[model samples]
Target: MPTGPKHQRFVFVEHNEEGQACGYEEDCRCMIGEDHDADASDESLNVNDAADIWLSKGMDEDYMFGFSEAQLRRAAGLS
Candidate 1:
């Protein structure tokens, strides 16, 4: 079983008053909840073979949730 402190994958999009997407965010955190481990690594996210948060807030979700043909097929269980 995985033994590292638990982390939750996240994705959020902020909307403005005009109903347009204004910000996007994604990351892995050591469960920022009522309970947490002090030793948990804040840099739990890995990108490009390195421990890092792939994208910070303020970007659009499209880049992270792109609809490539391969991804679509995988999502539809066609692969």
Candidate 2:
């Protein structure tokens, strides 16, 4: 099991009043009702609300893998 601070992944977007897309962000922290101070814009939303919004985007597939426990130790010169 993973033991650490729980984190929810989400995406944010900024759009104009004409219902046209302007910009978007992947992996936004304001998914679970978090603060929007980091990205003070006219609009903000979650990643799951694709159908609800005029335009929405998805995050890219992260092909990079995380380091193993042993690999971490070796890199720290503890092995």
Highest lDDT: give the candidate number.
Answer: 1
Which digits, one per residue and each the tens of the lDDT, describe model 1 over residues 11-45? Answer: 43433333233444444444354234456666532
**Candidate 2 structure quality by residue, lDDT tens digits, 16-63:** 334244544444333434444566666634222322221122222231
The regions of model 1 sitting more than 4 angstroms off are: 1-66
The whole-model C-alpha lDDT of candidate 2 against the native structure comes to 0.35
Whole-model alpha-carbon lDDT for candidate 1? 0.36
How many residue pairs of model 2 clash at the backbone? 0
Error of 1 at 16 (Å): 25
Weakest ten-residue segment in model 1 by summed lDDT:
45-54
Clashing pairs in 2: none
